[model samples]
Target: MKKISSKMIFGILTGIILGITMAAYAVSVPSEQVLYSNSATSETTVNGALTELLNLSQECKSRCPEGYTCTEKKLCKRASTSTLHTETCMTGSACHVQNNYKTYGHGDTITYGNISTTAGTLKAGDAFDCDVNGNGHYESDSERFYYVSTMNNGHMRADSNIAVLAYAKTSNTYRLSSGHISYNNYGNTSYGPQYALNELYNTTQWKNAPEIRSGHITDSSGNILKLNFSYSGYASRLLTYQEVSAGCSIPAQVVSYNSVGVMDSGGPLSYSCNFLLEDSNYSNSSNSVYYIWLESGVDGRNDSAFDIDTYSSNVSYDSVTSMNYARPAIEVPLSDIDY
Candidate 1:
């Protein structure tokens, strides 16, 4: 565990060059380490010394572990790609390359994190693994989610510390009970209307994801939905219109379905965005598709909430008490996710 430095390596190299020069031209010195030949040409001796230096440098570079390059500073880190040969080297000792480098990318599959997932990456529409019940197993249809967007403080590069928004990969039959998220001027609040979805978010969903820290989302009327635990924060909520259409090609079209799972009105709202259309798990069969609830309620409709029909990628609305599904979405730090 000895620390190697650039200055020390430089000093050793200087000594070797001076020793070789004296050994080639000066009177023979009785030293076991120095090899002196009377008939050898100076050019031959110089070439021999250069070959030894090359071997010495290569030996140290070979110790550098994967994902980490031995830097000129002799410090092991994940900053640059330059290797040990870019600088001088030590002859006998191995360069110390620390085992601390790891790479994270937009589509890199990770095994574990503060919240675990079997299939997931850092790209939009990618699988977001979350098991809500602490049962160690996720529902077959609801086992994964789509990463909708990256927040202001998030990133998708190597060694990045960030947070992203995740939406349910499939739909569920969770009902959105009726009422109104009413507020009074006297600081009194009523969660009775949005209570159904709130209960599911705060209690049932994301139960196993403790790393989903508190956050906030805005509504159509400039209202704020805090996902904090202190006041009335939700653990997992629905997506919004702006969120779904951020970098996607969502058209002005609308699609709808009845409570009995029948397409009643509107046409397909086929949308396309980064990797969203590339999800292999997305269903093409109508039987497995359902409407996904969004966080924002209809602009002027108090008893209704916006929803996206999975069958058509179309946006629509439904009564709060209707039997549509709740596709929960959450925000989590990228650092909390392991590579």
Candidate 2:
């Protein structure tokens, strides 16, 4: 009886050592951690915790909710909410955090929102994609690229309301809707920017243009969700010039009575279009990157137009005729589209 008891104890000890070794190996990779249930407690034994964590990993690829990020495929947290995302987020919208699998070189295909953009190679610093209007599918040109924008997923809406798993800087593009290209500040809305967005959504050179349509998500219940992927130009809804400027990360500047657009409530917001030249998103920081143009002498107000000299780093706003870049706020709701 003593010999049998000894044998049983030996087996248990051996198994315990082996499990600890395996668990250590499992979480050794940097930033990766074993998934633990919110209900897990310290009272749980080490062996029990390890066993549960290991099993749960196999059972679920990720426990992250939509718009939430899965850190190292273990720690799940809410994505950061910039002003742009907060303004555009719908009542029940939950934004997704950028997921750049550290294994970009080897992990499974990268899915930005609902689109499979980087199969493996196309390089990006953070694994974010921007082509949502056309579905980003260009068979003729296999080599695709993305604009590194200041915008994040919180402000992007998926095409046709399909839930996508990613967001890009262009999500701020929808801000164009706040003003009109043809008529600077028409009434209270910017019809010009809105027109451009519509053009992208409706007209396309390709055969199967991406449009708002019904899509499906493969959940455990296999439930089908109506993915209403559309651009909310002011989706961020941050109409105040200060709000937009801060969201765009523009350099601070002086301003007074700089009314650029009208408000939905009647009068134009005081600082709606306080245009500045220095805050463009491109690395070069030139007017070519992106900028906004206010209606010059329409009401005999300050011209507020600007021009950047690439050579001297000088900005001139005297001329009203010069065409300026329009930095609009946009939102993409990636709640639809299949995974």
Candidate 3:
């Protein structure tokens, strides 16, 4: 309000001019205006961004749990939907189950001791009881006996020759022939395809020749001679003999006995019989006597024919005698006969 000095008045006028220049400069600065406008634009862009808006929309729709977003790159994961992950119940593999059951095929051949059999498809732990066949075994008395007789015919002395008496006995699967016992003072003996008693008896020691007459023998009184013999046509001669004792006593005489003279001799002279006798006794007692009657002669000759014609036809003979002192008789165990 008081009149100022000249310097003070000029200073006041300079201050007013400087203040107006500062305000105009601030308003006219383009950098500050551009900075404000850019800040606002940046805030608006963030609020309206496409990705952010999508995330918010998804969150509102509950597409994913809290703090999660439905993103194209990070989709929801789930359990596998493929069938390859499942297990199969049945498989065709060799060791696999079929219809919930196990099956097997033919396995390798297995042998146990002296027995063997065909092994077919079976379970791993399956077991079987085996019995072997085709091994030589006793067929029957008739078959064995017939076989021996057929072999011995015309080769062994009928009257002096010991008969092959065969008894039925259970043998292994390999013994299928009749066993014999000799009337000689020899111990028990055996003969077969391997042990031929007929052959042994025909040797020089026996001095007896086989009569090829297959007819029954009779005493001078026309009584049929008692001779128990097997029907086996495969008989073999005694290969060896072991003297046991004199003739078997009455209790033991079923096999050991003397043979009467042959039908050709007509003298009825008893011959000393020493050989294995057939096991075919009339009864269980050893004293049982067996009679012999010519059933068929070799070469198809009648029993009455005695000449060479008859002898030629006689395949085997049945000779019986009385009071002949043949030493101990031999016996062939049934276990040794080979079919």
Candidate 1 vs 2: which has more lDDT: 1
Model 3 per-residue lDDT tens digits across residues 70-106? 4432110111112101112221222111222332222
RMSD of candidate 2 to the true fold?
Answer: 19.4
Arranged by TM-score, best first: 1, 2, 3
Per-residue CA lDDT of model 2 for 94-200, tens digit only, reads: 21111121111222222221122443221112222233334533221111112112322222222333211112222224333432232122332212222223222
Ranking by lDDT: 1, 2, 3
lDDT of each: 0.40, 0.26, 0.22
Q: For residues 158-214, write the lDDT of model 1, one tens digit per residue.
A: 112433444433233343332222121222111212443442456444555543343
Model 3 worst lDDT run, 10 consecutive residues: 267-276
Query: For model 1, what is the error of residue 110's alpha carbon versus the real structure, in angstroms, after optimal superposition?
Result: 23
Determine the backbone clash count of candidate 2. Answer: 53
* TM-score of each candidate structure, all chains considered together: 0.40, 0.25, 0.15
lDDT of 2 at 142: 18
User: What is the lDDT for 48 in model 3?
Assistant: 39
Query: Is 1 or 3 the stronger prediction by lDDT?
Result: 1
Best by lDDT: 1
- Kindly report which residue stretches of model 1 are placed more than 4 angstroms away from their true locations once superposed: 1-122, 130-143, 151-193, 198-208, 211-217, 220-234, 251-289
